[model samples]
Structures are given as C-alpha cells and as structure tokens.
Target: MTASRLPQFSGKTGRPELMVILGSTLTVIAILGIVTFLLIREHAGAKETATRSATTIAQLIDADVLRTVELYDMTLQGLIAAAQRDDLRQVSPQIRHLVLFDRSTTARFKGDILLLDKHGEVLADSSLIEPRPGNFADRDYFQAHVTNTGSGMYISRPFKPRCDCEDSNEWRISFSRRIASSTGEFLGVAVASMRLTYFDQLFNSLYIGSDSTLNIIDDAGILLAQKPYLEHDSIGKSFATRPNVVRILREGSGSFESVSSIDGRQRLYTFSRVGNLPLTVIVALSGNDVFAAWRRTALVISGATGVLCIGLLWLSWLLCRELRLRHQAEQELAQLAATDSLTGVANRRILDLTLRHEWFRAQRSGQPLSVLMIDADHFKAFNDRHGHQGGDEALRTIAKVIAANVRRPADLVARYGGEEFSVILAETDSTGARQIAEKIRMAVQQLPKTEGDELPMTVSIGISTWTTQTDVTLEQLLFAADKALYQAKEQGRNRVVAGS
Candidate 1:
C-alpha cells in the first residue's frame, strides 16, 4: 500500500527574489546600452563638427593665398613684358623704371622686384631707379628659370636677403617667371619676393583654437609660414620627411587625423592646394580642443548613469529582502495554522482535511483507510481530582505518546475536543488499525504517574477501517469510530476496541 504524503513548502521562497534580481539586472543593462550608444553617437558628431570647421578655415586660407599669389604672378608677367621690349631701352631711365614697376601692388610685406638677365645679373629693380649691383646667378628662382625654360612661374623656398638690413633677416619667398625669346631661348627671369609676414597677418585674423595652427608650405615640402610657430626658425625648414606632411602633399587636398611631427600632439589636419600654385594651406586643430566639451559632457552623464544604476540595484535588493521575509512569515503562519496549539501535533481541522483527502484516494485505489478515536480514561473524575491544569498536562502527555506510536508521516494525531483525541492512518486495514490502537493504549498506560495519583495515566482507543467493500460514507466512518470508543469505555477503562 502506498502511504500518503503531507504538504510541503520547502525551497520555494527564492522564486520571487530571483525574478526581482533578474529584472533589475536586465533593466540596468538596457539603460547602460542605450546611454553608451547615445554617447558614442555624440562623440562622432563632435568630431565631424570639428572636421567641417577645419575644412572651412583651410578653404578660406586657400582662397586668400591664391588671390595673393595671382597678384604676384600678374606683376611678374607685366615685368617680363616690359623687360622684353626694345622700345623700353630707348626710353628715359625714369620712364623705363616707372613703366616696368607700375603694375606692382604696394603692400606692407612686399619685397624688391627684380629683372635678371640670362647670366643672373640684375638688369632692373622695382624699388630703385638704377638697378642695384646685386648678382642673382646663385638664387634658386633664377637658377630654375635658366635651367628649364618651361619652369613656368617657379615659387622658391623661403630665404633671407644676404644684406644686414633691418628687414633682411625676415623670411621671404620669390615668385618668378621665365623670360623667353620667340624662338624659345631663355633670356632672363622676372621675379618678385614677398615677406612671410603676409601669412601671419592672414592667420592672426582668423580664430582657430588657442593651441591650433594655420600653415602654408611649398610643393617641395618647405615650410614657408606658420602662425604661432612650433619652433625657432621653423620657417624655411623642410618638412619633406614628416609623415603628416607627406600624406597632406600626396593627397593634395582632404582632412584627416594625425599626430603633429613637432609636438607629438594629435591634431585634425584639414588641407587644400592653392589653385594651380605650388602652395598648400593647412589648418591643424588640436584634438584636445576638438573634444574637450564632449569629454566634460560624457563625464557628467556617465556619472549620473552610474548613480542611477546603483540606486536601482539597491532598491531591488531591498525589495528582494522584503519579499524573502514575507515569504518566511507566510510559511510560519501556515505551519502554525496546521498545528495543534496544546499538543504541537496536527490540529483537528488538519486531521479532518487529511482524512477526507485520504478517503477519496483510498476509495479510488481500493486501499483501506483507518481512524482511531482515543479518550482519556475517566477524564471527568481525573480532572475533578487533579484540576484542569493536571488534566491538560495528562492530555499533552497522551497526545505525545499517540504521535510517537503512529510513526508514518501519513498518520495524524489531533485533539478531537475536551479530553478526546483522534488519529488517521492511511493505507491500513482492520487488523493493522487494531494493532496500532493497542500500541497507543500501551504507550499511554506506561506513562509515569504524577504525585497523589492513584494509578498511572492511560487511554482507551477505538479503531474503525473503511475497505473498498465497506458500504459507509465519510460521516458513517467517523460515527462508527465514536461508537467503538463508547464500547471500549463500557468494556473497561484503558482497553482497545475494534468496530465493524
């Protein structure tokens, strides 16, 4: 026969706690993911904004530099046209000088304009009525024109004049055109020089960040001018080997990020080639400046996000703790509700519930269900002699004995009211029920006597079993057990009796 099992609530308290932790974790992760995605997108936007701003500055420089170079080229072309005229030789020296230099635009940084003959001798000077006795055969611009007649509009690397004049120490670059005969023989060169101060003037007017720089370089990778120069005498120096410069020159025009060869600080380099000329304009914006605002914003936002996530987890922990405590309290309440207050055994209500449940199960499985109705022998006279306290004590002792003898978990011992008690034994027939009843009677009979007691305490038990063939209802089963208990009392106290 299969014994019935009691209800249990063990190991089921953590389900709500697990759900709370899992939900909070998922919520925190989702928040972090969204915040991180937003931050990354904002960082990209900051970089793009910086790039566009740099490109704009570079284009502005390109336009201004192209315009200035065009002016110099025009002056060189006019000087060449005048120098090639035989009619100008017959003119007066003053008129010849005026005619040759009339097209030159006067500017603060403008330098001497000279016409050189095939041998690099100064044939005319724009600043002087009579040409200075200066030889230019060694000059790069003069040498370039003489060596290659097709070296159209050669722009020379930065150089200083040989003289010790106050401004001669300043850096200067020359724009020169090859003066050729109709037969294509190189006759001489027309050259004009401009001081590097023109670039400083143009650069200083624009605002690129405090650490950033605006630069101009020749096609040969010679630095012509820089605003806020990185090093002393940086102008006229060759940057041909620098990785950043090489990329800028190779690509001709574009924007990129690279570490500056001078300071080793990263920068965003926006560059453009000045219209058909050998000059490139660059705007190098400091990386720190470009992303400074973004870094500050990210710091604040990340801190806030961290605090939010921590707070959420803390709240979840508190909620889980409360849920655990509540679950424990609920289980304790349920245990108390099912236990007898006086004997610490299954209460009467629980016994009834268990008996009814076992009855249906027994009926379906064809197993016998047994009930043992127990009574304290002479409980009225005993109570009159010992008072209610001693009687209660006797009842507690008898309940403990009955519970000890009924060892199976499916068996229940409960107070049936007054000095009466009851037991439910699952899967036990008449013979088994009678044997168990006799054992309960013997255990109560063996109890130690109290002071002033005439005899040892004892109990009389009556057994009733319901088999598949028995024609009895649940109420009839209980009535039969009660009737047998009366019979046991009538037979003699402390004896076990069985009912049909």
Candidate 2:
C-alpha cells in the first residue's frame, strides 16, 4: 500500500461534469427567462383588451339609454301640449285612428296611447276600460309629475297596472308632464305608460355572447326591464337595498360586478345614465365569459412556464446548480407578493393600488364616484348561535354571493374588516346609489339563514356619493358610506340607506 499512493479526486474539478452542469443550467435559465417575459407580455395585453372592450360596451349602452329617454321626453311634451289645450278628446281620436289606419306610428311606437287627468285618472285610453273612471292619484309617477315645474321631464319606475289586463300583470315605464290650464295654472298630468316588454325586446336585440345581459332600472333603482325576465320581488323593488347598484347610481355611471339577483350568476357590469333623465341602462356579461379568452391564454402561458421550469431544473443539475436555485427562489417570491393568501381575491394592498388608478381615470372623465359600506347583520349573533366554524362557513358563503353580484370589471368588492365589505361604484348619483343598496339587501335575504338564530342574518348597507367637490379620496367615500350604514342600522336592520 505504501508503494502505490495514487492522487485523490476532489470531485469539484471534472471538466466534463463542470461543462455539462454549466450548459444545462444556462439553457434552463434562458428558457425560463423567455417564458416569463412572454407571460408578462400576454397578461398585460389581455388586461388592456378587456378594459377597452368594457369601456366600448359602456359607451354604446349609455348612448342608447339617453336616446330612449330623449324620445320619451319628446312624447311627454307632445302629450302635455295636447292636454293643456283640453283637446285630449281630439288628440286621443287621432292617436287611435292612426293606430287603426296608419301602419307607420303603430309599428314604431308600439303601445296603446293613454290620457290621464291631474291625479293620474284615466280620461281616455286606447285600451278601453269599463266606465273609464279609475284614479291613479296615489301613484308615485303622478305625484312626481305634478310637482316637477322645472323644464326637466319626469320618468316613473316600472309599475303594474291597477286595471286588469288581458295580458298578465305587466310592468310599465311611464313618462308624465304637468297639464296646465289656459291661465297657465297646473291642472293635471298627461302621462304615457309604455310596456316594459318593449324595452325587454330592445335590450334583447343587443347580443354579446350567451352570458351577456342588459337591464334598465329607474332612478329609484327598481328594475324596469331585463332580458329573460326572472320573476322575483326584485323586479319592482327599490334598488337602494342593493349595495352594488347603490354604488353605481351614486357614481352616476361606470362598471362593477355583483351576483345577479335573478339567477345568482356572477357578472361584470357597465352602466350609463340617460342624459337628462333619472334612468340607468346597465349591461352585464359574466366575467368568466368575458375573460375566457384571456384565461385560455394564461393556461397556455402557465403550461409553457412549467416546461421552462423543468428545463431550468435539468440545466441547473448540469450547470451552476447554486445560481439556478437562487434565481428560481426569487421568481417564486415575486409571485407570492402579488397573490392573496385568503379568499384568493385581490388583497387590500392590490385594492389600494387599483383605487388610485381608477380614481385618476374617473377624475379625467368627470364622473361621480361612490362607495358602499356593507356589514353583516347580527353576525356575532350568528356566531353565538352556531360555533366559530359555522360562522366561518357563513362568511365564506356571503362573500361568494357578494362577489357574484358585482356587475362590472372595474368595480371592486373587498372584505374591509371582519363581517364588513366595501364596494366601489363609479359614475353614479344619489338616487342610483340607494337602489343598489336595496338590491343587495334582497340578494342577502335569498341566502340561507342560520338555523335557530333569534333573527335572520342580513346585511346593512350605507352608500355615499362623490363628486368633484368631494375630490377623489377613497377615505372620504368610505366615511360617507360608513355614515350611511350607521343610518341604515339605526333605521332598521337589513336595509339600505344613503348618505348626504
């Protein structure tokens, strides 16, 4: 043994092994870098495309709504002028005769023409009612019309007819103007009630794929018409209870997401106010549907990323293993930073960033902004009735429902604190804000309540409207919503109330 002492191998200086390891590591790093770059580019592109698509759809819907309102205004003006002259009998005859004799007016403005007195009493109607002596004096539309002395027009929320119709109780959207006597004293109201079905048909014509839908709500947030009408109390109920819709109305216009009150489908929504009218036209498409293309792109990117990662691993084993490991660790860290740990929705940090971006956009566009503060009613009571585990489940379910109801891509719904959530509605107004709150209320009521609880678990919503005077401060909006929420809770639980 002493005669044959051979040189020992250090295991660090095998030229062939070193070269193989370096080459493999370099190849993997290069592949991963390329994949990462491609993924980033694709993500940015897809997001931009989605934003543009949403914006375009919003503009189109807004224009259509305004046009429809303008038409309504014109019709009201004509009817009022006729009423002022006390020539309803003559004009009524002409409208009926035109419907019978002329095909043009019949086809275009497809509905029975009607004349109502000062109190919304039916004086003359195309569809003849027995005795012709019913009074609509108590109707909100009639009251509103009589009071509006301003040049602005008055449009009513959808309502069912008091008189029985051959057709089932159909919803009608009415436009009214005050009738004046020869001396210019207010006498009565001249009104027209257009069947909401007409709007249903109109909105149905706008096709944006299978999951897309269009809806119209009055200034009060009552759903006037929708395609594929699902019968629920929500159809004629005040929208003020819906947190999401309230946010939209207060903001005056823009997009948000929410669960469909009808079918519970999660939707991305965009809305526009009818210029010079208290009406909102909302267009909603399922987020899943809208982003299906982007999802596919992401999946492809993900798969490529995985392959690149595997390649990196292989290359690291053959090349500079330590360096490759360090690089991979860094990449993972960045991903973690961007992701939310709980609920999988974007975290508050991300929301803050988004709010800032949205704020600037809204400011440049000169649109109103609103935020909703939502609190689960008697959540602690629920927890007391059912253990913490049950409470957790309830919270999760509520969160999912709230998330589903949000209707716009730009709208953000976030868990603000324990048992509280916030929704951001852009380009809305006070009346619109209240409607949304009511919608949210009805939606939560539909959810399964805790068993054996003294009272049913519900949500209280507070909405605050923002304008240029308010500036673009999230804190101000939040405070406004909080104050409104306090009022809602004070008035009663499970209600939506608005802030000043």
Candidate 3:
C-alpha cells in the first residue's frame, strides 16, 4: 500500500493558476474596498446636507416665534401704561375725534383693544363683549399672571371661547402680562387673544418642502399649534407616546429616520430645542429627497464597481471564478444571520448585542432607564378574523406606527414576539413612561381599522421605570411591563397601565 500511494495534486511554486487566483482575489477585495469607501463618503455627505437644512429652518422659525413673543410684550406694556394713568378712557375716543376733525384722515383702527384687571377680569374693553367688565377672571392666562410674578410676558395655551355675538365662533390663542403699579404691586393682567386661524395661516406659509410640517408643543408636550389645524381633543393631546419627540425634549436635540406622522412617507428628521422655552422645532426631509445626490453617486459607483469586477474576472477567467462565488456566499450568510426575516427588524441576536451595549452606557452615565411592553389587544382574534396574511399586515402597520412615534436616537422599537412589541425608553421616569403609554394608546386608536371589525384595533401597554436604587435586572423590568400589559387587558383593552 505504501508503495502504491497516488501522487498529490500540489502545484509547482510558480504555477500560473495559483498566481491568477491570488491576483483575482486581491483585485476583488480592492474593488469592494473602493466601493465601500465611496458609499461611506456618500452617506456622510447626505447627513451633512440634512443637518444644514434643518439648522437653517430651525433658526428661521425660532426668529419668527421670538418676534411674536416680543410683539406681545410691547402690546401689553402699552396697555399697562394707559391703564395706570387712567388715560385709556381719555385717549381712544379723544384721539378718534381729533383725527376725524383733521379732515385728512381716511384710516380707522380695525382691531378691538381691551384692558384686563389683575385677575384677568376685563375692566374696560373697546369692543364691548357682553359679561365683559369682569369676565376673564378664571382664564389660565390671567391666573398665570396673578400667580407667577416672574412671568414677564406669557402666551396662553390655545382655547375655544364662547362668542358674545351668538352666531360667531371664535377660537383664540391669548397673550397676557401682569400689570404692576408704581410700587411694583400687581394691578391686573392685560390680555389679547388673537384668533388661531390667523396663526395657522402664518405657520402654513413657512413651508420647507412638500411634506414638511411645523408643530408647536407646550412645556407639557401638548400640541398648542400646528400648521393645518386639527380639532378639539386633537389640539391639546400629548405626544408623549412619540418616543422621538420625547427624546428630543429630554435630550435637547437629535436626528433619526422614520415614517412621517402626516404623510406616512419615510423621512430623515432633525429636531432642535428652543432655548429657554419648552418648545422643540422639528424639520423633516424625505429620505429620497435628502439623499438623492448620494443615491445617484452610489449608482455611479456601483456601475464602476461592476465594470471593474468584470474586467478582473475576464483577466482571470481560467482560475478565479470559484473563489468569487465562495466569497459572495459568505457575505449572504452573514447578512442573513444579522437580519430578522419575519419583521425585517434586527433579529434577537442583534437585540442582545444592543441590550448589552445600552446597559453599560446607562451604568456609566447614571441615568434613569425605562422599558415598555406593548401587546396588541385581541391579536389572536385578529388572526382568527383576517387570517395569517392579515395578521402580518397588522403587525407591520403597528411597527410603522411605533417607529413613527419614537423620539430619540437611542430609543429602540422591536418586535418582541408574535403579537408583542417592546421599546426602550432611556432616561425616563415613571410619570414620563405613563404619559408615553397613553400616547401609544391614542396613536393606535387613530389608525384606520379595516371594515366589518366589531372592535377597533388597539394595544395594551405596560411600562416600568428603572433607577440605580432599584437593583432590578433588565429581565425583571421586562417582566414588570408584561404583568402591566396583562393588567391593562384585564381592566379592558386599548389602554396603558404602569407597573410598580
């Protein structure tokens, strides 16, 4: 047997086939490396463009808001001066008469002017609204002026008020300031309420692009004003459920890619927080629009890469084809391992990697952390009613909704299971977590349900807040939220319930 050993197929040291194989492998790697570099450059350029656009828009809007605030301040000061001298009575009618007597005057003042007392009671008003002389005492603006001495000038939250002229409907945004006497004693609050329709018009005129939107949220994350005005409960509703907005408010500024709330288009958003104000300005640009140039560049680079690859293959056709196939197969395997085929989100393996990374980050920063366990209410029923296809569609829709609402870059939205989703709300407290849960409820309700469904689609959300003192494991936090989700279902569906 030893004498009959077959000859091995080992090639000579300088064999042409071995040289061709090595040369082709190196060429392919170099081509791939060049393509990757170009892609990275394109991505960076797109990001820079987006950031610049967002910053410019934010600054312009900030200027307008500040100007409005200043105007309100000046108007209040003028009113206060007149009220203090008891000259408002003498100035208006007297001035009108004088002007009329001067013969050259064709203009007349078109707006009503009112003077409010310390408690927001209208002491004197030119327009003569009924129940007026003492009507506004209970108004929020008036109350704010009376109580907060430091509040020099205040803009009231939007509200709808009954019209004195029975046929008219007027909803207004009020601006107010405390009137102080010579010795600094509070005299009264001077208020002016402008119809919100006009404000809406002004905001609408400041468009960035086709689908761009502007919203003004108050300190409580309440939507005080928007370009295309929405109705009653919709106006003051909190967006706490929107994790992205929540993140901006908490962290001051951030950017992310997500689905738009208004148009349902994919977009890259950049948010800037207004200085010394409970306001955040968000500028969103469509992903395609923002990265159009980069995409074009990518296409060009890809074409070049293809050409280069073909040239290399042609040069080494006799030897290197098998090696290229093997390399491609490895890449495919790696991509598959990292991706979740069902939801198209990161798979459980990736999630574990993320959790460990975020855990260490929180530990180093000493910040509060929270988690939300979200379960679709009656999801099994949905599966039964619509079949697996329908269920899959519903899951995708819910995922999109959740993704749209997350406010922070660090926040994670994941499909935890068949009918469950989870969110990691960083640096959040219990109160904040509860508010976020409610927002999720509202957003789900707002989704259009399919025809013939007895109950509209809804979710049961469980939230748990974490702190350094808690000594609780991440698993424990998940368990708490899960328990809370069950409680929410037990209490009836479509609601948020928080765990201790």
Candidate 4:
C-alpha cells in the first residue's frame, strides 16, 4: 500500500515546479520595482507640473500688472506732450481742464492724475476740486522729474498718497514724467498716483490659498502692491534683503521652490519682472496645496498596484497548484509503466532501462556489470499437463524466487518475457554473477505447491559479465547471456552457465 516510488521524489518537487516558484518570486519582485519606479516618476512629474502651472499663472498676472503701470505712464506722457505747446500758459482754463481730465472716464484708473507746477505745486488735478488742495513737491518721483526734465516715466516705491480731499489709509505708488520747455527748462511734473486697489482688484479673482501670495515689488524689492494686503506695514517694506528676491533679480523670470520670508512656509514660487518696469510680480503656492493633486493621483495608482499584486499572487498559486498536480500524475504514470502487474517485480521495459543505466555507471567506475538470464525449466510441459491457471501459478512462484534471491539494492530481477526472467547486478564480476544465478536456480527448485501436481520447479540461468576494458557493448553482453542460457538448456535443465 505504501508508495515506495513516490517517496523517492517526496521532499523536493521537480525542476518545473521549482521554476514556477522561482519565476513567481521574481515576478513579484519585478512588480514591486515597477511600482517604485512609477511612484518616483509620478513624484517628479507632479512637482514639475506644479512649478510650470504656477509659472504660467505668474506670467499671466505679470502681463496685467505691466499693462496697468504702462497705461499710467502713457497718460503722463500725453500730458508732457501737451505742455510742448508754445502758448500753453495762455490757454483757457476750460481747455486746460480738457487736457488734464481727458483720460478720467476710464474705470481702470483707481487714482488721480495731477499736473504740478514749478517747484512741485499741484496746479491742476484730475479729481477736479475747484482749488486742488495739496502737494508742493518732495516725493522721489517729483524730485527725479524736477532734476532731470528728460526723465522718462519714473515709478516710485510704495508710498501713501499725499492728499487733503477725501482721504483714506490706502497706499499708492506714483508714476511721473517732467513737463519741460523746448529749451529743456523744467516747467513742472505731471504725476499719476497708482492705487493699491489696482493690483488687489486684479489679483483678488485668483484662488491662491491663504498662505499663498501675489505681490509686485520694485527693482529694489520694495513692496509696491499685494493682494490680501498685510495688516501690518508691508506697504513700503523692503524685501530686497531676502534671498528669494535676489535670486529672482538674478534670473529675471523663472519658477523655484523656496521658503517664504514672511510666512515661513515652503512654497513653489513663480516670479518675473513686469515688462521693462522695475517691478517684479510673484505667485507663490503653498507646499501642501502643490502636492494635493499628486496625492490623489498616487492614491489611485497605489490602489491599482494593490489590486495587481493580489491578482499576481492568486495567479501564481493557481499555476503552482496545477503544475504540482500534473507533476504528481506523471510520476504515478511512470511508476505504473515500470512495474509488472502479475509478479510485482520490474517489467521488461524497466529491466532494459535499468541495465542501460547500470552499464554506463559500471563503465564510469571501471567496474564489471553482470546480467543473469533465467528461464523456467520445462514450463510448456507443465502448462500442458495442468491448465493455464496452474501454469500461471508456477510462473508466479518462479518470479518470487528470483526476486527473493537478489538482495542488493543495486540488483534487479525482472520478468523479461513468457517464462523468461533477468537479473542485473551492478559492480559484480563473473564469479559473483554465477553464484547469485545458482542461488536463484535452487530457490526456484523449492517452490511451494498446495494443489495439483507436487512436481518440483527449477530455473536454468545464464550469467554474463563485462568490464569497461572488455570489448563488449550492452547489446553484445545481452546476446552472450542469451546464448549461455540456450547452452544451459542444452546441457541440463537446472544449472547455471556463465559467458565470458
């Protein structure tokens, strides 16, 4: 009942099974590697995408700020062009009002356009108070324009507008140009006060987060205007000392990651100098907000990877199961093929295979291989006297006797054919083969009988042996043993004959 053949292959599965496990393990490793690579790529891609998007936003807003400042300067340029008239000092007050307030209807203008007289006195104002109340000089833009009549459109740093009419705490930057005579004598300064709300209203529509920032600063990094304006004194505050501003100045326009000097938050910063103006526009995005979109993408990718890992594991299990079952069935089929149904000994198919394998082993070891060819003596006569049942029983008895006499694990006894048997002895010489052949012959001579005739049974055996040094092939060895068997039958029925 025990599976002796099965035990030979027990603890270890075959090469195909090993390959399944090895291949599966490697596949899992490769999957993990791919996931790692994907995650790294996704991380880099997400950061890059965030940086580019921020830069685009910055560029768009930079264009808006540039246009706003340029328009203010263009108004000053128009005023200065009008002052070139020779008889302008003699023009009617009505005509002068037409010249000063010509650009007032535009809603984009959040500040007053003023014309100053000699020594920075506010002569005519765009806001149109009958006797315009303030401003005799001293602003940087005023000083710059008075000193150099040719100074083209000067933009001053962030400052509070000096006015007496309807006043507020709000700040505005000034854009100024000089009004001069044909001989280059400074007549006065024409000024435009750029309202802070201009920049705020422009940036308010954007959805940058609380910690995020949108600001425009002069070349000296003085805060010109900012959205979500600082409750503290950020207006007129200098940021030129910060490293981020220095880098922006050096690069002119680019995106980078940096820590904020104000909020101390890490941000992806996109900045550019506003179109030939001394102003720089900045858009800063918080780190958490920048990575938020990437987190969602990574979650989806991880979910898919988790599902794939499970699927791969399941596939490996199923494959190994199927392969193991098929391997077991093949092993069982091989066992059946090599075993004899009637005698329980090796059949002729196995005998041939075992002899070939042993022959090669003996050759390699430089040892002698011996074969015993046994035939049941007078088997046909016994079958004729007692029917086939009795004959079959006699054959069974002889098989058991042959099997019992061969003791070594390396020795094999097989039913070679009808009434013919064989024994293959490994590492055996002629004398050893002859002795075992005689023992099997005597054992067959004493087969027990519980029925019909009580006639004694015997087997005539022929022995053959060869060493690698001998000129004998496996076929030649087999032929010599068969010939010796015929001779044993010729001389007597129950003896052994050995062939050289």
Per-residue alpha-carbon lDDT of model 4 for 248-333, expressed as tens digits? 87888888888887778788888888778777888888888888787888888888887887888788889888988988797777
Question: Model 2, range 421-470, lDDT digits (tens) per residue?
Answer: 77777677677767776777788888765677655568999988878777
* Top-TM-score candidate index: 1
List of clashing residue pairs for candidate 1: none
lDDT of 1 by residue, 336-404 (tens): 777767767777777788888889999889999999999998889889998998888888888778877
- Best candidate, lDDT-wise? 1
Those runs of model 3 whose alpha carbons end farther than 4 Å from true positions after fitting are 1-11, 86-113, 126-134, 164-171, 182-185, 227-234, 258-265, 273-277, 319-500
**How accurate locally, in lDDT, is each candidate?**
0.87, 0.67, 0.68, 0.78
> Relative to the unseen true structure, what is the C-alpha lDDT of residue 353 in candidate 3, on a scale of 0 to 100?
60
Name the lDDT value of residue 358 in candidate 2.
Answer: 62
Whole-structure CA lDDT of model 2 = 0.67
Off by over 4 Å in 2: 1-41, 54-65, 86-112, 127-131, 181-184, 229-233, 256-266, 320-500
Stronger candidate by TM-score (1 vs 2): 1
